[model samples]
Structure formats: C-alpha cells, structure tokens
Target: MSTLDTSALVIGVDFGTDSCRSLIVDTITGEQVASAVEFYPRWKAGMYCDPDRNVFRQHPQDYIDAFTLAVRNALAGVSDEVRANVRAMSIDTTGSTSVAVDRAGTPLALTEPFRDNPNAMFVLWKDHTAVREADEINTLARNWGGVDFTRYVGGVYSAEWFWANMLHVLRVDPAVRASVYSWVEHCDWMPALLTGTTAPDVMKRSRCAAGHKAMWHESFDGLPGEAFLVRLDPLLAGMRERLYRDTYTADTAAGTLTPQWADTLGLTTDVVVGVGAFDAHMGAVGAGIRPYSLVKVMGTSTCDILMAPAAEVDGRIVKGICGQVEGSVISGMTGMEAGQSAFGDVYAWFRQLLAWPLALLGDTPDAQSQRDGILHRILPELERQAALESPVDTGMVAIDWLNGRRTPFADQTLRGALFGLTLGSDAPKIYRALIEATAFGARAIVERFREEGIRIDEVIAVGGVAKKSPLNMQIVANVFGLDIRVAKSDQAVALGAAMFAAVAAGLHDSVESAQRHMGSGFETTYTPDPEATAIYDRLYRQYREYGALIERLSAAEAHPAPHSTELCTPN
Candidate 1:
C-alpha cells in the first residue's frame, strides 16, 4: 500500500441514519474540497421500519447503493489528479447498529429467501424490539458470580446494543438463526466490506463499537465468556468463535480498498481503508475533543462524548453512562459516551403526529401538497414563536423519552410523558416545552458525569440540530448553565472520519496531529441567559419528577401489585 505524504487527499464517508455522505479533504490543510450525500432509497420509502413496533432496520443494499452514489458523485467534479491523490478513506456510522452475516460476511438480506426479511437486514441503532432480551441479559449479568460483563460499558446494557439485537433475532427467526454465521457492528462491517474482508474470521472489528456495545474488553480477555452467550440463549452456542475477538481503533488500517471498490469509485487499489468507528465518536474528534470537553453530536439522537487522560480516569468505571473505553475516541485517552435515544427524532415525531391529521382529513392532491408544506414550516415557525416565550409561559412539560432512555440507564420499556397540558397550550407552547425537555435530558447526562467524578469543563455542540436550532442551542446552554460552542464544520462527523483516514495512511503520525491541522474552529457560542437558567432549573426538577411518575406507571402495568409503591425507588 502506498502511504500518503504531504498534499495527499483522503475521503471520509459518514453513514448516518437516513443517508450516506462522502467528503474529500486535503490531508495537510484539512480543507474539504468536495462532498456529496445520497439518501437511502429503500429507507426513505419506509421499507424496513415498523414504527408502531419500534422495529427499525436498514438493508445493506441501501448502504451499498449509497456508497457508490455518494462517492462517485463526490468525486465527479474533482480533477483526476485529486481523485488519484486520494491515499486512504475512512468511515463512521451509527451504532451499536449491527447486521447478521453468512460465513462469507454477506448480509443475509442481500441473499435470496431472506431478501425481503427485515430480520435479515441491518438492525438500526434505535431499534428497541429487543427490550425483553436486554432485560434478561442485565438480570443475568448482575447475578453472575463472574466478572461483571458490563464493567467497560455502563452498568446497564440496552436493547439498542449488539448482543440484544442478535439474540432477539435468533429467537424470532429460525431461518435467520440457521443461516447466519455471526453478527458484525455497522462501524466495523462497513470498512471491512469495502476492503473485501467480510469473512467472520478476517473482518476487523471496531474498538468503539465492540467496547461500548458488545462488552468486548481486554480485561475480559475479549468478549464475554462463551458460557455467558449460551446462558443467554442456547441458539448462541458456538457462535462466539464465529465473531471476532480483537478490535482496533479507527487510526489503524483495516486493509487497502479492494480492486472492485477502487475501480467502481475511480480510485487506485492502493487506497487504504481505516478501521471504522461510530459517527459520534469520530464527530467528537472532528469537533476537537480535549480532556473534559464534552462533544454533543446532536442529530436524530444525541451522542455526548468526552475524553480525558488515561491517568485521570484511573480505570474507574463511570456508572450509568455508556461505555468508558481506552482508545475508543483518541488513542491513549479514556473515552466516555452518553446520549439520549431521541433528540431530533422527538421533533420528527411531533411533525408526524400533526401531519397524520392533515393527511387523513384533507384527501385531495392539493391538500396533500399543503400538508407537506405545512410540515416543512411547522418546526421553523414553532422555533420562532417559542423563542419569544419563557419557560413559565406554557404550563406544559415534556420528557424526551419518546424513543426511551439510553443513558443513566438503558431502559427501552419506558415511554415519553407530557404533563401539565392545558387548553391554553398551543403548538408553539408545547413545542417549547419539548425543546426544553430535550435540553433537560442533555443536562441530566452532563450532571451524571459530574456526579460520577468526571468533570465536563466545556461543551461543544455539532450535527444538524446544533447548527440549525438557535432555540435548542440557547436552551441547552442555559440548562447546563455553561456556554456551548458550536463546531464550525457542518460536516464535522465526516471530517472527523477523514482525520482518521489521514492518520491511518501515515499522512499524520497520530489523530491528535491530524486534528490540530484539520480542526474546524468554533462558529458560534451560546452563553446561558441568567433569567432562562433560573426558570429551566426549576422546570428541570419537575421534568425529573414527571419522568419518574411515568416510569412508575409503566412498571406497575408491567408487573401489577395490589398497592405497588416500590416503583421509581431512589437511585
């Protein structure tokens, strides 16, 4: 493989929830030269999601299609020299999203008989259908006499994670279970797919995904013991060896781009593919992470990443957060992750909720067009009107758990709650309350870290929600009672992936050096307003109480008791 020297170019592919984006950057200057994005056609058509059941899947074909389209389009306008100068590429994807694969590493959905089966597709990160299975795993882990499997990850694991999804599928689909050889995380599989190393034994796994979601760690001597998997499900018997044991950080090369992929993308075969990582972790890198600097990737969901010196972390497990792993974000640093399951998703839900009525009541073609128009304007209008109101203006309060809680606990069974609604409440009033609820959820994560002895000295916001929503930016700042700096790059996640690509290709000796050269400076800073801060503090307390009540109600329904008062016990 050819190593990139000075003036070399690299590509960073960011696979998001809805689309894939390719970014070409100058290795030396970190300047983005060209970029392109293409939505997942099948996903856009709602082919793999059953929203009613909280089942979300993405076909690997959607990813393959987007891969070719995004990269080809991105390089379309660039000069031949620029395309040829591309020394390496790296990718970041949503996680703990994972997919079932055959012995050859092909996703089952890509083959016949399983071609249209959602169970055979890539399970998206937000899929919560495995809640019961996750609960079982947690119960077992807590009671096990052996080392806690959740030591590296937060104390609690979630249905949104890897093993839960895999076990859930195995139990539900005998055909899939019989055909599948092993499972691979999206972040790990994508790069391996590009490098033609999808074989279960040869495919490289990601430290970020494996450490955070699959409970793979050095202390455990790799994955959870084979006995643990068998205990969880007899169907998992002998599957541990099919999956990988070793994991690499994003700075390492998975392999050179395969000849087929190189030819398809009009790049040379020598282009290296860096080991992959989840989008938020790389986004944190793109946002320029420092010790105690919290990077919030505020997209459909929010992944809050923080890294600190390894000595400071002292191998202390920060309970109730996501995984805290070494080299997951930056090599030689301790990476900590926390996130809400839904952020922008909450807004999208509200939009869908309102649009249902417009679509049902107004059936004409003009009416359908009008409904689309209304949906487009609703959020922006709400933001404008809500910005004028104070926290007290609306007697409404919302809990940002529509997609369930991801941090402080990984309970998918809990649902969202909205209380204190009155006839006086209008669209904007309720909307503002929802926005505040999200900010409050974010604040809870920050506080959880502090409570666990992890300091967050600064907050950096990135992704679509951070750049587009002034109200959200200000509210989060006020809620945290700290200034929030928005990263300058709108494509920080992709840019961060590119930074990794540069390092893997030897253009930079390390990720820190690449970050120093390519780091996009801050674009805007949101300073907390004193008046807003006081009001939010009061409401935040109420939000927690309200959320607690909902949790109690959910638990009571799940396990009925004559006079149940044990629910929502103090943590």
Candidate 2:
C-alpha cells in the first residue's frame, strides 16, 4: 500500500531511564523529521522508589502510556501519506532493567493486586538492592567447576544486572514470584510488544542484553547450565529453559507492527520492527563507532562503548568492565561496555544537599521563585565560579560513588567521600572536585581496556553531559589525555535505533551501510590541555589511593578481626 522512495521514514524509539522518545528520521539524508519525548509520570513523581534503600522501580503502565503518547505526538503533524511510507521501527532502552511477566506475557505490575506493588514493576538499571545476591553469584561462580560465567562480564557479576535482580525479587516477594512466568529486559520487551510477540517463553531476546548483562556467551553454548543455576538456587532451576537460547542482533527484524498498535500510532501495519538493544550500544552506532573508537554516552549515568575487530581482540577477557560481546554494537565486531554509576547524578545530589537551607525558607511565593531560579542557574554558575580556581587551589578530591561503582569492578556497597574540605572551600570548589571525580571514573574504564590489549584510537561523546556541559567535556578531555569529539546529534541514541530500523526495513543492506549515510557526525572536538592534563595525572594517582583506602576500610568494617590481612593481600 505504500511506496518505497528516498522520502520514506523510519522511527527509532529510545526508552531512557526517565522518559521515552520517538524520533522520525528521513531515510535518504538521515535528517530528523520530527520527534517527541514524554517522561514517565509516576516515575517523575518518585512514586515507586526508596532512594535510601537503593530500590528503584517503574510501573509497566508508565512505559506503555509514555510510549503511546510519544509516538502519537511525534506523528501528529505528519501527512497520512508520509505516515504510510514509514519503513520500520526500532527501539533501545536502559540495560539490565527488567520486569516480571506472566504466562500471557503481561508484566505482573499490569495485572491484579500486583498493579499497585513496586516489586511487580520494572526494576531500574541503577537498582542495587541485590548486592547480597550478586556477591553470592561471584563466590559460587568462582568455586564452581563449570565454565566461568563471570569471565566475559569482566570477571565480576553485578547487582545492577539481570540474574541478581531476579534472584533477589524471588526471595523478597513470594506472591509476585509465584505469579511470574519469566522475566524480560526492557530493551527486548519494547520490540516484542510492538510486534505482538509478548510470549514469556518465545519472545525474541537481544544478544546485546543477554551477552552484556545476563552472562550469555558463545563459550557456554547459551546461558549457564541448568545445573549451575540450580546450584545457585532451586528456584532458578528451570528459568534457563523458559528463557530463549537464540538471541538476535538489532539489524534483524522482530516482526511487522501489530494492527492494534499501528492504528493507535497512525502507521501502516507493514512497518517492520527491528530487534531491540541497550541505549548506549545503539548510541555508539549512532556516534559512528569504528574499530578502536570509544563512544561515551554521558548523562545521569555514563555508558562507555568500544568496538574492535574480533580477530584483533584475541578473545581476551577484559577484567573490571561491564562485558564484551560480539555483534553487540556492530555485526562483525566485538563490543565492549563499561560505565560510571553516576556522572550528572553526582551534581544533582550536590544540588539536593544544598537545597536544605532554601527548603526552610520556601513557604512564601517569593522564596519559592528564588528556589526555582537557584536550581536553574546552579550548574552553569558553578562552572563559572569554579573556573576561577585551579585543581590544586581547593586541595579537595571527591569520589563519584554516590550511586556505587559500576565499572573497573561493580561494587554497590561503596559510598562517596570527599577529602580536604576547609572553611575556604566554597560551593564551586567542592563542585569542581565532583566533576573531576566523574572524569577520573571514566578514565579508569578507558585505561582498563587498553591494559587488556584493546586499542582506543579516538573518543566520541554523546548525550546531555557531552552536549550541554562544557566544563565536564573539557575536564574529561584533560583527564583521559585524549581529544574528545562530541557527536552532532543530540538524539544520537534514538538516531542509532533509526539506523537499525533502516537496515531491518531493507532500505540499507546492513547497519554499517545505514550509518554511512545516516550518521550525524562529530560537531566539535575538545583537545586536552597539556598543563591541565599534567595536573589531572597527579590527582588521578591520589584518587586511586583514596579508592584503595576506602575499600580497605569498608572490608575491615564488614569483617572486623583482631588482625585482618584481606586489604593488604592481593587477590
């Protein structure tokens, strides 16, 4: 019913940690035609999370509601003919975040009494409530004679990942656990739901999600053996059987859009739906990731993506990273992921901490307006003031672990610390230290890859921090001692998904071809300052020593003995 032409469009849906965005892009020139974003209402209201406990969840209805709104709004002004010619749709979502589903493929939170329960909802990517479960996995995997499941995932299992979250939920909520038929990642579910393949046992799983977060690797043949899972927990005995063994790449089509969804979004049912992936992985493709090129998606959190030729990597397992998977970013290359648990989040936390005094004087309307104005100007003003002081002027250093360490080893038990605070240290002085801390966290990830023989020739940055925060960008450039190129597209993650959609719809032969024509390219480069780089190099050593000291103290506190050598002895 629709004609294929240069004017055809493909849509990319990016379901982020806080919002869902729908982007319509022209197939010919990769120009963005229209886009709309809608934040999760309940999530924005903070209805389902206890930040103090590190518990974060989002109701399934919020995702459904936001997606429908975003798509409809994005397509509002387009002509009917233009809508009919849309070739395909693709999706990307925050990783490791999953929801428990019923036999009918309905998320538990969408049905019955569970509708009001937070545990029945989607666990967010940053949720670290399963720290104990993750520790158990690491210990058991190390002792088990089977293939090391943690090897591909940086020799460490994380509370922020799949199995730990599943195991923890099963232990905590017996009602939901009994009702849940299986689990599905947010990335995989969006595409499956669009194509009407929401079957618990048969929905398409993503190689990106499975390989990076669920310990799925070619070496294990599929997921870890049932015997190994049973050893971990009897409840997990049959989960592996329920989950699909075959995972597809983003270039593959999930299926055609269902008529029900098609009508709602004013699209033709013929539009194909491509397989889904994590946001950062798709973002790397959007940023034009080539072999040895590192792409960092910097936002509330940071997800660092790098790809290399499979032959060049030599199958070496990089320690202390998120994971390394073949075809995760590009079809023929090995994609490696690493990240900081908090980046912009550190600045946000500081703002909240500073708001206490303002909160006490907020009853009057004038006071409220003043509070609002302060929030608006805080970050930019901090950057302005902070520029006046040198890194050594403050003699202060901070750790960006308020949300825990996500890479170079995943440890949720760690908390942030700041040293050298003095009466002379003002708000801007402390803010500078926080920014520097996040930069250091990123540097650790890059260094880890190189230490493991993975080359990084160029660095590309995409996302809010990269685009809007000049201070952060320059600091990152200096910290890594490398030139940082910021992507031109503000919506690179969504654009990357659109590229996959183009391939799935046959507009392009592969993702690479689509990228060649559709990529937004780099807009600006921030080269490291020789003077600043040298100063950061010295501060980095101190940061490492401080991190080690904190770990020692935490270990001693956790296991107090008359004399403990755990900190002193090497693992």
Local distance difference test, each candidate: 0.91, 0.90
The clash number for model 1 is 0
Per-residue accuracy of model 1 over 1-571 as CA lDDT, tens digit each: 3244665998999999999999998877778999999999999999979999999999999999998999999999799988889998999999988989999999999999899999999999999999998898888898867778987788898999999999999999999988999898888888888899989899989999999999989989899998888887888899888897899999999999888899899999899999999999999999998889999999999999999998889867798888998999999999999999999999988877766778665678898788888889988988999999888879888999999999877788888888888888888888888999999999989989988888888999999999999999999999989999999999999999999999998988888888888888899999999988998899999999998888878877777766755554433
Alpha-carbon runs more than 4 Å astray in model 1? 1-6, 360-367, 562-571
Q: If scored against the real structure, what TM-score would every candidate get?
A: 0.97, 0.97
RMSD for all candidates, in order, please.
2.1, 2.2
Measured by TM-score, how close is model 1 to the native structure? 0.97
Q: Which ranges of candidate 2 are over 4 A from the true structure?
A: 1-4, 363-367, 562-571
Q: Report the C-alpha displacement of residue 185, candidate 1, in angstroms.
A: 1.0
Model 1 lDDT, residue 309, Cα:
92
